[model samples]
Target: MESTEPQRYRFTGHERVFHNVSAIEALPEVMALFGYQRAFVVCSRSIRRKTTWIDRLHARLGDLIVGITDEVGEHSPLSNVLIAAKQARDARADVIVSVGGGSVMDMCKAMQLCISENAYDRESLLKLQFVVSGDGTEMLTTSQAPAAIRQIAIPTTLATSEWTPVSTPIDDETRLKARFVVPDGSPEAILYDPALLQQTPVRLLWATGIRGLDHAINTACSSSPHPFASLLAEKAVALYIRHLPNLGDTTATDSFTQCQLATWYTGMGQMSVPHGFSHWMVHIIGPYGDIAHSDAACVLMLAQAKWLEGWVTPQHDRLLAAIGQSDTPFHAILHDLLAGLGMPTTLDDLGLTRAQVEAMIKPALEHPLVTRNNVRPIKTAADLRAVLDLAWRA
Candidate 1:
């Protein structure tokens, strides 16, 4: 008998802009929506070091700004979440405004939850924190449940965290792949500003550009399909295909808009199918491999895409064409593009030795989430081993 399980989902997003806007004017309005008088701005060390945007935001927001928490780091590690939460608590910040990429946004997301609940560890936190009423009820009440944090995201990078309900957090002990926090854990608003992106490192600019592409392509090929999201994903693919090559040559705003649009659309798709093997593998190898999330994500995209070729549908075919390739051998074409973008084309480049690959299989095979969604299911340790072999040899 064929197995039966639910194959569809409803997606919701944060109430905010995912487009280019003037930060000087937008920040205050977002703060007002969350009813926050004092905001604890969270950002990456890199953004803090390089940009005057944060200072300008503080100056612009004036009294609404409580203080700044500039200690956010890469990967939204659990420890850093604790630290930021503590700092936000100490400052008595009424709301959080994150002003960087995925890492910063994710950090604020977690901080909101921790502060609202007065808890630090994820293990101690309540699961299924919010539920949509059958009659369409929203908002979790203090009487009915524990409260979560209110967060606002000002994304400077195109990694699409603003669009996703899932947040990747690093494990302290293993230092490997972390847990995924749910959408209810996300910020209340996401403010997109292209001016903030201008200050990003050239390398990060390219990496996040590819990162946004991965979001689009991965969603296009996800197990669950939606006509609207597929169209948006194709559009995102077209944007990256055109803009990525012109990095050294263009001052294009449209491409970034395309990326932002794609990120927003695909981020919703992710709520349904989310990421597949690539995301799982990245999670498996992240902390353990010392690979950056974007780098790890891009590294596995083509390899996973190659695996996804056999599962191609008309929708997938159209998406492939948007990236300037025919459906036939789509994986090969995608890999070629990834190689040109300076992304790691193989697992070896990610510091995974033969022994480590062998060690990673058990955990990967055990992960029900990623393994189950694969176009070709991964059922055994050997199946994961083969995927690892392909990734290692890439």
Candidate 2:
């Protein structure tokens, strides 16, 4: 049943999504839209050394491409963010063009904050975090400054970090994420090229699509449902279920395009919806086990879906209808879908031990995200442990 609650859906820095088009083709017009020319490109090191994509981009942007850095690291380490922030600042870059996955885009967004606030060091950067009170109210000071330096993302993976203004740059000192909700910090425009996605290794590619699928499913199962959010997630679920199974087909560019489109619709809606245990648990278990975020989602989504078998029946019905299949239970359907995609489905499959799974229990219980937004109440270590047991072998 839908809750009788009013909700506000906020749009951030997102302006345009140029799909089925390469970055070299779409960037100039996007730059003209903002009347900006100077671009500081950020990408993965592999793309820089291995691919011609960067050289091509440099050729296209010409003098407008002032500087480029590929040192953001996998998790967007805060130290790396500080380093890259200075590079973009010194270059006097008007925009940051992220040409990689979530970490690179996250690095660019944090760089925008560091440059704008002129806060460089860890202590100063840490101050940017919002404080939460005992009553669970958050206190934050906003500059309300219009975004001076926004980002333009060309994602190589299906994790749709480009759609969000919030960036989580991990602090090396604490080994945890520092969240920043910057005004206009999101990509001002996103370029989605299925051809670019094809360059990603197949397992990695399918895993990220599963991550996008995670957003759709968990948002659909959000305790406080927004009708529009649920509606978009419905479509997203269908698309993901349809196209993600075709991961092995390298020639299937249109299917890959469909996967990319599915991510956008899911990301747009899930921005407003509070997610469930599967989503929040990914943060802890993924990093703990050194698994990629999307890979972690592949395993945990199945685990949590199985765990929630009885509790979320109504929402499961909604998802079933969306996929036009009312026969199989949602978890089983998801398990078969993931199996068909050759994705991971258990903690064992991810190479995580029982000890590691046991270790994450305290953190999951302690995490404010789980406490505040997880679909079901997780009040104790036992509560988390119960669900985790199902994950041992899926």
Highest TM-score scorer:
2
RMSD of candidates 1 onward, in order = 4.4, 2.1
| Candidate 2 local lDDT, residue 43 | 96
Q: Write the per-residue lDDT of candidate 1 for residues 314-385, one digit (tens) a residue.
A: 656787677666745666766776777676778877767888767777777665455765667666887777
What lDDT would each prediction earn against the true structure? 0.68, 0.81
Cα distance off (Å), candidate 1, residue 87: 2.0
Candidate 1, lDDT over the whole model: 0.68
lDDT of 2 by residue, 1-394 (tens): 7556777565654888898897787888889898888999999987888888889889887898999998978678999999998988899998999998888988988888888888789988887864443533232335345566888899988877887776777788866667677767878889998888888777877888888888898878887677888888889999989887776798887888998898888878776766778877877876667777888898888888887788888889989998988998998888898888778888888888888888877777766675555556666788788777777775
Which residue segments of model 1 deviate by more than 4 Å?
1-9, 121-148, 180-183
Kindly state the number of residue pairs that clash in model 1: 2
For model 2, the local distance difference test gives: 0.81
Query: Each prediction's TM-score against the native?
Result: 0.87, 0.94
Model 1: what TM-score?
0.87
